[model samples]
Target: MAKTIHIALVGNPNSGKSSLFNVLTGLNQKVGNFPGVTVDKKVGSCQLADGLNATIIDLPGTYSLYPRREDEWVAYRVLMQQDKEVVEPEMVVLIADASNLKRNLLFASQIIDLKIPVVVGLTMMDIARHKGIQIDVAELERELGVPVIPINPRKNKGIQPLKKAIEQTALELYKAPVRDFINNEALAPAAIGSVKELFPELSDYKAIHYLINHESFALHGHLQEKIESIEQVNNFNHTKTQAEEILQRYQRIGSILKQSVSEPSPLKKTLFTEKLDNIFLHRRWGYIILLAVLFLLFQSVFWLAEYPMNIIDWGFGEISSWLGNVLPSGWFADLLINGIWAGLGGILVFIPQIMILFGLVTILEDTGYMARISFLTDKLMRKVGLNGKSVMPMISGFACAVPAIMSARNIENKKERLLTILVTPLMSCSARLPVYTILIGLVIPKTMFAGFLGLQGLVMMGLYLLGPIMSMFVSYIARFFINIKEKSFFILELPVYRAPRWKNVLITMVNKAKIFVFDAGKVIMVISLILWALSTYGPKEKMRSVAARYEQQIKQHPEQEAELNRLKNTELLQNSYAGLLGRSIEPVIQPLGYDWKIGIALITSFAAREVFVGTMATLYSVEGGDDADENTLMEKMNAAVRPDGTKVYSLATGISLMIFYAFAMQCMSTLAIVKRETRTWKWALIQLVYMTGLAYIMSLIAYQLLK
Candidate 1:
């Protein structure tokens, strides 16, 4: 029987660790939460030579053994074997960026102390050569006492050898005494003495972790007596004093590099990196470029999706029409065609937009310009009480809020992370785009605003822009109240620009698009079906009586029969289950200028914003009449009159509805994710109450003022 070997890939942030993992594992990966924390655990399996297999766990990137954030803490925990459920790796593959060896070596040395089988995979060797840096691979391997393989993961080079080294090392077929920490001679005696006195059984790395103030040491109850003994020997605080000692170790590593590493020439600054950064990161031009890029992105989503959207629309219509003709014209037939089909149609029509947006984002991220954008925006973000870390998640909100909130885990500060999560949903996600597009199309004239800008497009742009403005306002206010004083710094690695790997981008695009279509599709479909049943089969006596009364009039005046049947169907719908439900809530929404039909759509739309269009389609389709066009729906909505003869869906009502969606907590998945991330219901509740209240007040003002 072949044993399953475990390998851990460790590296610093932006070291191409994830890209390497993707190359190695491909589709043989699964992402799960670390035992108890929200930190993600990515594990995959790969088949090695000789029919052997290995499970590779990609640990979160950390600069040192000392962890500052929860995700990094999970990494430390896994490596230390502090948790019973977490397994220690048989071998550790330490990935280092060749161009930035000084910073990358800091972690490499820490891993060497762990006594695990280790191999060094030097990434970004191409960039290093471009910058006139050269490494003697044989000398590096000898100096590190382990195999050092130079790799360009992006180009898929040096992968096979790296895999073979891992497999060979895991089988204990190779062993070498790696170079140990050199400059910590003064602290070694004290470190060993404390280990012997306090944690006699602990590994050297675990002892080092205790010396460096890792909290897991304290969590080990078995070490309490030893810790007390060590404390008595040293009057100094172990964590703080030892951290200073660790800094000396880093200095020693620097000395080793100075002696072993040589630069072929004075480090030459590349004009390419500098020139690109000059324009893309310019203070004034950067913002302009960002806005232009965003505008183009949105424009592409709208203009490009039209063809596919039309195809999907026509397909759904055909399916509904066919169902209507074949089914027995009863509740079941109505449910299949109008309810389920319409609801699903509303969800599926947005697939093209989602794919295009995600593909663009993936390209930006893979090319590494996203990091520069984060760096460029950091100063501005700090002024509003956020950091560079908040930008990606905030930008991600434009695509979807659930993942945006989940991405906040990268933020280390609890308060800052919470604030980011709280306000992220307020950013208009793609779900709201459908609502805004439809409403703006109806209310805003297509003519230019001030004879230069497209008014409708500008209004849509304004709605998108409103979200960040509101998020910043909320974050600023929260910052003032929260008493956090930790000094935050932004340290981002701007990777060398390279052609985006289209394969990776396409895979990401497909995954994200699939998630949206399937996850959101199921909810909309079920709701639509339920709604169809309600609309098709009401109180039988009421519908039968209404139809009979209309039939009598039709028999008396044959020419009026068509008009009378239309009236009878409308009346039946008003008395149906869905209609009764809508009527019950009419009084509450009357101030917003919505009638029973709009009320029904609003109720169904709580499941998803795009469902509103589907609800309208289903209600109209069940009437056994001609399919309503965009113009027809708008005209019917505009001409709807309340008991007092006031028009429903007027300019005031449309604007109010749009504003309502702009700030409302309309997404349940977003709420559920918030709850999962915060690990409490309190924050999610706060989001729900505040966002709903804000939406209600804003909508009320718009309706009242416009009225």
Candidate 2:
């Protein structure tokens, strides 16, 4: 059997790295964490030949080999062969942005000098051409001493040749570079020679890295001490050496580019991207455009998803009715319909909204407006003790907080990163989407203003916006107490705007829906079943007494048997174990306009916010029984009433409940991720207490005022 060839994909940020990865791997990819770190490891396998299968590891993007952030450290370790846990790649595919050649080549040149066999895949050629930049690919290849393949990952162009180049390079059939990109050995001759002597396998470039980053490397204590001693004896200045190395490499790059590349003079060039940025990034109009964009996004979620969401709701309701008639009437049948099916339906019906929401967010990111959003919000963020970098994580929080918190690792300032993590959960995630949709549908009118602005969508947007607003307020107050002072900087590279990739958008929608189904779905299903059982059976004597009394009542008045049966179910549920648990908390939550049923949802939803919908579906299903054959969760919830015969989901009650879910830190997964990211349970517990407490107080005030 042929051994699987290992290859690493390295690139600078926004150099089409992810796009190329998606094109190469398609659906044959899996995400996992690198050993001993929470950084995401994206690995995929592709058939390079009939007998040759290659595994590709997509490393985090970095501007240079020098590591600062955790992600950069991970990339540096993998490339330098310092991480023992990872398999060292036999070859590397270095992605470089053609439009940003000068900056991109800095990292590319460093990789080439590491002595790793590499193929350069140049991306964004169209963008480069739009900017009036011309490149001689053959001449550039000859200059760099490596085969260069210009690839447009968006259009799936140049992939076959790129793959072939990678194959040839990995097989060592391609001619190797005759010399290094720069004279690495001449930087510090004595220290480089000494380090290389200690480790014969290391290249001149790798040896220098060890001298500079030995403290961070996984070297043995004695080796670390030896390197420190060498450093002290040679008076090696890591900073000066790094500066010199960069200067020399760039100087060589300038000489190389002079022969192989050309561009319009900077004074004469006004690219299409600049023309568009004039409007999108305008000081005054930018904020207005951003709001308009977000408004459209939220409105589109409802408008486009209306039909599919309704179809899903109707399909589930019909299936329930069909099962009610077809299945044998028994506890098993009841469990299947009300316990499992109800949970599944509750979770699945929101798939359209989830897909649309994610799809829109993906478009914003693909179009490169996401970076602009960060730039636009930097001023506002810094006022609250954060900077532009915090906006990405907070925006990502809308999709999910688990990954959002992890993304905070990119923020260089420790205090800012911590602050970003602490309040990010407050940004309403998609888990809260189901809760928001159902409540907004319950209370907010679907009427449109001037046939465009939907009240329901407006409410949804408000819920989404409320999260960041509250997060800012919390961050401002928390900064004073954090007690860590550091100068904050916000430096961002705005990518040239381009059209959204539809394939990527579709994939994002599907993946997000799957995550919701399989990940959050598990929690919802379990909670639904447990809730079903608890709502169905109580203390044995109380259950028996309730059943017997109902039977006696039915015998006395057969004409009222339907009403009597309904009453019995309601009373029996009130006496059941689930009802008892809910009632215990009802007193505390009543001020928030939540009764025992909503109380039960609150308790079960602590596992996950989306589980509230499933819990309510299960509870109401058990309580309502087979009285309504084709009743969807929304219908059941809509018809529910309090003891005074008032609608349970009145405007005030719905608003309060929405507010509660808006502020509550109800996800255990989020809590666990916080703990992992912070490496302590203290922050996690604090997050839970403060968020839940704020939810309670805010919910109480909203309910009282509205009532």
Candidate 3:
């Protein structure tokens, strides 16, 4: 039986750690939450030579052993564990960026001290060569006492060699001496001595911990034993502290880099990165460019999705119509055509918008322009009480708020992170687009503005822009109450730009779209079915009495029998269970110009915004005659009038409905994600209460003012 190797891949942020893992694992990766936390744990297996298999765990990116964030803490905890099931890594592959070796080496040196078999996966070698950077890999390997392989993970180079190295270390065929390879003994000894003198009462490992400022390092029992041995050394004094000792170690590493690394020219031109950044990060032009990009994104969602959306709509409608004509008229037939078919159609209509949004986001993120957007917006964001890092999550809200909140886990500041998560859902997720599109089309005039900015287009832009402005205002108010003492800085590495990886982007789009349709769709379907049932059956005695009264009127005015029958169906619907429920809630919503039927749709839509259309479909199907045309749903809605002979879906009501959805917490998935990200019910509850209240008040004002 061949031995199984456990390899951990570690590196600083933007050092190609994830890219390398993706390259090695490909489709073999599995993503799940770590044992007790919501943080992601990615593991994959690769087949090695001679029937051997290596399991690779891609640890979360971190700067040093010292952790200041939740995800980084997970990395620290996993690496510090000694148990086989927990923290045992047979070999650690440290990824370093060839273009920025100095900064990448900080984390590398800390891993070297762990006494694990280590290898250096030096990425971006091709880019380094293009920029005239030369590195002697053999010298670097010899100096560090570890194998250093120069490869580009993106280009699929040097992965085989990396795998072979892991196998060699796993089988114990490769044994390299640990400390003997360092040529700078003088600096190492002095640094060790400094740690001993600082805290003589502490063990050597504890001293190292103090020197490194890694307070969590004391939790490891093996490190404590090593610290005790160093404490027993002769003439050790409790003088210098751990902080001082760690500073000296960094000083020593700097010295080693100076000795082993040489630059042909002290300052070579990095024209490529600089030239690109110059335009993308420009203060004024950058914002304009970003706005243009966003406009294109929205345009694509509306224009490009029309064909597919129409196809889905027609397909579902035809299927339901065919089933109704073919199947016997019974309870099961009604359930299939009116309940399940309508629910599924509602879900299918939103697919085009979701796919387009996901694809745009993936392309932006993969090409590294998303980070630049953050950098460009950092100063403005900070002025509004949000860190620039929060911009990514805010932008992600446009696609969907659930994953947007999940992405905020990367933000270290607690208050800023919380605020970002709270305001993100207000940024009009793609789900809201369907509601907006329907309402705007019904209400807004069809005239073009200067032949470019049409009435519908301008209204769409206003709806999309309203969320961010409201978010900023809400964040500013929230900041006044939440006190933050920690230092907040936005320092992100701008990865070298590359062509967008279509395969990765496509896979991501498919996965996101599938999850959205299935996860949220199930709830929508169930609610739609229950709503359909509620609207279909009324109090039997009441319906019979109403029908009998209408039949008497039909006989009295035999020439008006068809009109009487239509009025009877409407009366039966008004008295149905769904109708009574809607009437019960009508007092609360009447001020906003909604009737009982619209009330029912509004209430059911709180489960999901997209359910509104399906709910309306079910409501109409129960009342309309056998010759009801699918295209007449909107016309019926438009022609609906209140008991007082006033229009129900007037311009005021349509605008108010659009405003309500623009700010409401209508997605349960987003709420669940808020709970996960904030790790408390307090913020999520606050988000629900405040956002709903705001929506109600704003919509009321819009309706009253317009009316």
Model 1 lowest lDDT segment of ten: 619-628
Once superposed on the true structure, which residue ranges of model 1 sit more than 4 Å away at CA? 83-85, 176-179, 183-201, 211-214, 217-229, 239-241, 264-269, 303-352, 396-414, 429-461, 478-487, 511-578, 616-628, 672-682
Every candidate's lDDT: 0.74, 0.84, 0.74
**Candidate 2 ranges beyond 4 A from true positions:** 1-3, 36-38, 175-178, 323-335, 389-466, 480-489, 590-598, 604-662, 666-685, 700-707
Cα misplacement distance, residue 23 of candidate 3 (Å): 1.3
Error of 3 at 305 (Å): 5.1
Please provide, for model 1 over 6-107, each residue's C-alpha lDDT reduced to its tens digit, 9 standing for 90 to 100: 888899988888888888888777666687776767888888767678888999988877777777788887777675665778788889988889889878
Q: What value does the lDDT take at residue 631 in candidate 3?
A: 45
Backbone clash numbers for all candidates listed: 0, 0, 9
Single out the weakest 10-residue window by summed lDDT for candidate 2.
622-631
Each model's TM-score?
A: 0.86, 0.84, 0.82
Tens digit of per-residue lDDT, candidate 3, span 1-707: 86668888899987888888877777677665565454667888778778788789988888877777666777776666522345477788899988777777767766766556788899978777777767878877776777788878777889899888877777776654446322322333555665566446443343444444433443466555544555555333334443454565667666766665555585777657678888878878888998787667656756777788779978997888899899998879989887898877866676776676677767887788878877777788887789878887787677667656766766776778878988999888767877887688678889977778798888898998999999999999998887766667676778878777776676556655665576557766776688678877889999889989999999899998766776776677778887788889889888877777878777667656876775665555433223344346667777778788988778999999999889888766676557655556687789999998988899999999998
**Candidate order, lDDT descending:** 2, 1, 3
| Pairs that clash in candidate 2 | none
Please estimate how well model 3 matches the true structure, expressed as its whole-model Cα lDDT: 0.74
Per-residue C-alpha lDDT of model 2 across residues 1-707, encoded as one tens digit per residue: 76589989999999999888888888777765677665768888888876778899999998999976667888999999888878999998999999989999999899988888889999999988887899999999988888899999999999999989987886788755658789888988899888877899888888899999888888889989888888888899999999999999999999988998998888976777788899989999998998787667656766787789778878988999999999999899889998899778867766786677677777988998978887888898999999887886787677667656766765777789889999999989878988998798888888999889999989898998899999999999999988776666576788888899998788667765765566556756776688678867889999899999999989999999877877787678778887798899999999899989998788768756987876776656533224243246778888999999999998999999999999999976677668766767799899999999999999999989998
